[model samples]
Target chain A: MTDRILAVVTLNMDIVAGGAPIFFARNQEEQVKMARYLARTLDAMVHDLENGVYIIVKH
Target chain B: MEHYLGTIIAGTLAGTVARMVMLRLDYRQYPGYPHGYLSHLSLGFIASALGAVAIPAILKPDYTAVTFLALAASQFREIRGIERKTLEHLDENELVKRGSDYIEGIARTFEARNYLAMACALLTGIAYELGRAPAAIIMALLSIIFVRTFMAGETIGDICEVVPAKLWFKDSILMVENIGFINIGLKEIREKITAEGLAVLITPKNADARATIHDLGQRQAMAHTVTVLLGTKKDVDLPEFTPLARIDPDSGAVGLYAVPVERDIDALILAVKRTPVLESARSRPLKTQAGRMAAR
Candidate 1:
């Protein structure tokens, strides 16, 4: 867990921030799950844009 | 003896009538059961009894008895607290939650109603003590009518125009007429909304009306009233499908989207029109000289 933005999970199944596309999710539900997992494990926060993006930031 | 009986009958009748007129079980379903009604009625009775006895007590040189009126005022204030607590508790389960402002307004209304009942009782008692049976009966009827008129608040239609709007998605973003509502990237949710949803555009007649409708609590109240009349397709999980009132930045007109259980568009329109203006959301800027000058 680092004190920086870990990854950004776009609802369209793309990891825009962290390199190597850390989590590949099928749909919105999986996207949310993966985002939460990244947030919890990485000690981060999930910012749901309510459009199609969830930006995860390490706390 | 005759005057005493007349005062008792007149005061009780006036207070009871006022309470009955105010105790309504509409969409809110407040005072929903018989027990609730009984409690209010009993309170009304006690209020009237106190009011009716005031004149006689004063005549008998008992000044301390008037303190009971102050005691009743405190008791009625407690009713406001009870109403707030009850509504707040019930709000947790509401699909479209009534905001705290609305809840506070309702609680205040209940408290005010009890005071109105007390005032009516006191007035009727005075009239009866002065003019006897016939005057007492006449005053009671007049008091009921006056109470009814006073309590009749303004409705949404009085302030704005509610018209049907075409609900369509432009580039997968929901719009009512030209006003933007919600951005939905999901095709299924968009399709479901288009297939079943009803849309209405509420354009405020004037600047004051615009200010009133701009209040989020008022918009929510409009949604709740529409849901109560036409029902909503909303469930717990689906936030996108929930009834929403979005304002157009350019026009200040509100766009409403709701997928009703009953697809009666006319009834939905009527319900929106009939939705009572929430007290918390009322803003009469145009009535002020500064606002009028600014507008000019």
Candidate 2:
């Protein structure tokens, strides 16, 4: 299966902007929660970009 | 026809026994069911009958009967295709997949075993014709031993050293020994992995082995085998728990990470060591002059 970014969850909205749907969270806890939800729903993996941004990728 | 009875029976028995010996239900767990055994044993019997009849046919000066061996060979080729297709279908649903290279190796082995059974039958028939029951029995025993030894391929332990490796988190990234694994975004998931995860460092014994483990299919096969034996904590949606084998480019060593349901370190090490070295992944670069010089 081709790896593709399904969604992006970030505390800093300025860091992520693209074709993929992005979710803006107020804090780190909310970002992780949103990323986990999207990953489980999409059957994907949450990879940390290490800049308060987590991209849910289907691998 | 009456005089040939002893030879035919001896040959067919030896061949069937050889097939039975080769058909083992190991950790790989393919053909573990009763139906799988029945079909394979039936095919083995047919192969043996063909081999047994050849001697008597030749003794009767019926040279045309020898040509049927060509027909039997084509049939065995079909067995390889069938095995490949079956494994490929099953791989789709697996959390840890046995890659195409591993599937092809298994299919080739199944085809070769039929030929081995045929050879054992032919040798037994020859022995029976030459020296009756005693010689045939001796020959049968020897042929079975030869097939067992010859068909047994090298395992990971034969070409590499498997050692327990520490799993640690480097910031948000998972690390097995010095090799960086996947990036964990969730703190809870990271904590779970750090608490339950197991890791191993596989160091190749030589240049040839280094090339073998460098193959992506070989690494997948290693992960699949270990997951199958040890039971992975991964699920359909829990892709984070999926086992991974990543190579260390500088040392040519492989670091494998997994969170098993069993959580036994010794069993994990044994499972990794027992994984078969895939034929397609095997490379003998050390045999060449350029490789020899590069190794130094």
Candidate 3:
């Protein structure tokens, strides 16, 4: 039962601590919605682990 | 025994050749990789295995000759397609830089493809005598094993998402845009790294909100941020740039400064090193519906 996850990151990464609040223009959900979009455009990996969203920057 | 040997050899060789050709084509488009040979070797093995399995199965299970020929012709399109697709990406150096290094490392180093190829081979081996269902079962087990083994170092992190909306959850703590209400939401990583000069990959696009990024704080244990997006300049705010928090949208990276944030070092490097090793793995994911569209 050995599970090995191969993570091949393709760009310069800087882990921004999750849960760090970002004040958006709309509502809270709107923030997540914006974050989610930016995350994708940035080609980020938004992981759900350790009780947070692990947004990986895929170059 | 003879048949088994033939199958294995065929599979291994096939995996090797296919991967090599692909690698070669990829390398030609983007060259000068310091540690790419190892990747080539591993992929070669996997390709060899794939070839071994598929080629032999129809080799004459009951008139394997005709079947093999037909299969070859049928598969030619697939092979060509793979090549064509690869070529298209090859030209996109920025996209594939990290991909090449990573595939060479992860796909080749970890034998990720080999396990897949071998599992498939085993299924094929057994299925010839049994029915396809039995083979599918074996393949499933192989896949499970592969998954588990592959997940060993996986930090329970984000799953691959296709369209992570540009918005946060309604009740999220992290949001860059101004939300009238405050909800506790998970943090997000935002920003882009544009390389300028040697050892100078800088994040030009800055974010003003923590909600946009899960930045490493000075005191957090989760702050092992390994790769700092630095270029020829340290941290400078350009006139055209808007401030993302206190960080001045700087680009002239001539100096170095400790990233004033927190996150894991290994994982940070793993997360940011978009050298292809990071990109392919980072991009290859399974995202939820709401996440992919960006509309939220």
Candidate 4:
């Protein structure tokens, strides 16, 4: 994995990237799963930027 | 009988004096008060006795006494272990925890100091046996000075320059010297930062210093030192306002942002300059030819 930003997702009742809604997770567990799935699919790693925001990247 | 008395007195006194000379209450107040000094002094005496007796024991044709020096050496190793455990336990309660590297360095220093004391006593004993009491006293002074110089380590000021920089807000983002520091969306928090927060720019003199400053642990140590000297305005809930260091991607200059209770920039600069280069994060690029050329 390389240090390259895949997407910047924010939690606002759902996960949003680039001001567009991507996925709707009911709880923290679902959010984690979605993050992992997106990371694995994009060949990136997920990092929590806190304040309910996560950045997926490949390094 | 007079000769034996001279050796014992000279050796033991030299070791004890060395220990006392080295003892200091620094930033990490480990051996703090009366109790701590009491224990160290007693151990110093024992180490002194062991080293002092070495010369006389060999001269008296009693080889068994020398074996005790080996026993003393083992005990000193255990002392290192004890120091590490003590510091590690105390670190949990510290606001700015000393990293494992710093703790390990301290523990090694404590052990080494005891060994130096033993060596000092031994040297004084030899000098007394060679040229009487005056020679022994002279040797003790020389050894103490040698140890003092050897133990003195480098501070941050030797490797870099620290100067105050104004904090800037561009589109709700905090910037220091054109470096994107942090996002400050809240108007009140941004206002407070603009009013009181202090920013300092640290520029490394060479590649090695740049590598050292880039280490996250080193930056944390610098922030911790500043907080200890000036006091931080951070609370448990106020994570956003926590002291942060941002490095310029191109130039490798570090920018420190902190809102301290004491708003004295001069004191902050002095504190940062005096911060010891953390042993854990120290970079030594000058050791390699390619690295040396790049640094030059």
Candidate 5:
């Protein structure tokens, strides 16, 4: 079993606001892909404001 | 005695006439943006006359400067308490549906200030006979407080007094507080740990603060400023330090990171972006079957 169980899962996209679904990927790549997949559909605000923010992931 | 009566009559008439003019303009501008600016202008003029009265009132046996302040402060504090619907969860289409609502909201916020600024100006005129800067310092300090927060009690004077920035940061912050209304007092904090100079602001929405009727809409939309102090920098200020946070291509360093921490926040940000939805909202042009085949 992975030590990093799905504590909280959330997408880093703002289009859906706070209602998007997310899953716990075990690694960084999983995190990035999960981010890209969910993010591509939304029109990302291209400001430097959201670059390093780890949007709260839902459990 | 004659001048005092004249002043009162003059103020009342001026306020009434000014309001009538504004109301007239307000009527004309309808079906477009609401003409709220009229309130600010009229209120300012009206209050200036009333402020002249405040001077004599202050000298009376019962009236203290604080009494005038209490009246204005209480009135303003009451106005600051207002209802603001959270449009944060709204999508682009919804945003457009209530698009004009934002402007209406902005106008409301401005006019509300007109009320207090007018009250203060009126009080100033009344207080004029008292002394130099009698309440001027207090007024300046109070203005700093109100302008910074756009709300009472959250002013920089209050904040700085309670929570002084690190000694190194005190001056830049004073500059910020001094700049006051010129810059929205919304602040975020970001710091860079790498040689690349990456800056990430960590501003979690304060979920615990009370949402007063006065605290609605405008206060929620933006923060005043962002303060970043990594370890210590004895030699820098806000503007001087701000540039350090921007990306420098020549040096291959990332300047600012714009991510939210709470997943819900990212969802919120992503959900609100309108550029994607406008395309989704409209129907595509119809194509003839033959034309579709030709294109394909």
Candidate 6:
């Protein structure tokens, strides 16, 4: 299986854009919660872009 | 044929015993079940029979019977293919995979063991024909000892040193001592890893070993072996807990990170050290002049 960006969870909406589904959270807590949920649902890993964005990747 | 009965029996017994001595149910755990053992032992018996018949056939001036040894060689090649297929099928479901290199190494070893068994039988037959039962017994023991010692390959510990390393978090990035491992975005998961995860640095003894461990397949084999022995906390969905082996490009050292069910550091180190060095991953650069100059 190839790695794909399943979703993007971010505090800042301006940082990420493109084909992957994006979710914007109000703060770090909500972003972590959303990323964890998306990761569980998608069976993917949450990688921090470290730019107020977390990308959920299926590897 | 009656005159050769004792020679044939002695040779076949020695060959089968040699195969049994080589077949071990080790931590690698392949061919561990009864069914696997039965199939291999049966093949060993057939190979021994083939080897035993060769000397008598030549003595009887029946040259055609000796051609069966060529057939035996082809059959052993099939054993290697069968082993590779079985392992590849099993790897699909493993949480941590024994990479292709490791699988190939295992397959090759299985094929070689059969040859060793055949050789043991042939030698015992020759000895029995020349000097009777006593010489045959001594030859069997010598050949079995040779197979056990010389046929066995080196392990990770033979070429590298495994030492425990501290796991820390540099923000979202997990660090194994000075080497940066992975980027874990989840705070709770990162905290769990920092608190419980085990890390180790595999330092190569020389340039040849450095190049060998630099192979991606070798690193993956190390990760798979460590996870299997230590019982990983990883599940299908829990990619965060999956073990990883990362290399330090500057020093050519590999760092392994794992969250095991049994949190024993000593066991983890032992498990890594015991992993067989994959033949496909072996690199001997020091043999070359340019490599020797670079090492200097």
lDDT of 4 by residue, B1-296 (tens): 66987898899999988887767623242546787677777788888878898999989989987999999999999988998998899888665666676677677777877888899999999999999978998999999898777765666788889999979788667888889976553445678889989999999988989988888878877887788788887654343456788899999899998899999989888878877787778888888999989866
Best by lDDT: 2
Q: What is the Å distance of residue B284 in model 3 from its true position? A: 12
Ranking by DockQ: 2, 6, 1, 4, 3, 5
lDDT of 2 by residue, B1-296 (tens): 78698888999999999999888623263747788788889889889888988899899989999999999999999999998999899999888998899999988988988998998999999999999999999999999999888777889999999999999999989999889988887888899999999999999999999999999999999999889889999998898898999999889999999999999989989998989989999999989999999999
Which model scores highest in DockQ? 2
Evaluation by TM-score, superior candidate among 2 and 4: 2
Between the candidate structures 1 and 5, which one is better when assessed by lDDT?
A: 1
Those runs of model 6 whose alpha carbons end farther than 4 Å from true positions after fitting are B25-31
Two-chain DockQ for each candidate model: 0.11, 0.87, 0.04, 0.06, 0.02, 0.82
Q: What does the interface RMSD come to for each candidate?
A: 8.5, 0.7, 9.9, 11.5, 13.4, 0.7
Cα lDDT of model 5 by residue, B158-209, tens digit: 1111111111113112121112111111123222111112222212112111
Q: Specify the CAPRI tier of model 1.
A: incorrect
Error of 2 at B160 (Å): 0.5
For candidate 1, give the lDDT of residue B9: 72
Q: What CAPRI grade goes to candidate 2? A: high
Worst 10 residues of 5 chain B by lDDT: B159-168
In candidate 1, the second chain superimposes onto the true chain B with a TM-score of 0.94
**TM-score, B chain, candidate 5?**
0.29
> Residue B93 CA error for candidate 1 (Å)?
0.9
Off by over 4 Å in 2: B25-31
Q: Give the Cα error of residue B282 in candidate 4, in Å.
A: 3.0
CAPRI verdict (incorrect, acceptable, medium, high) for model 4: incorrect
Evaluate candidate 1 by giving its C-alpha RMSD to the native, one decimal.
5.3
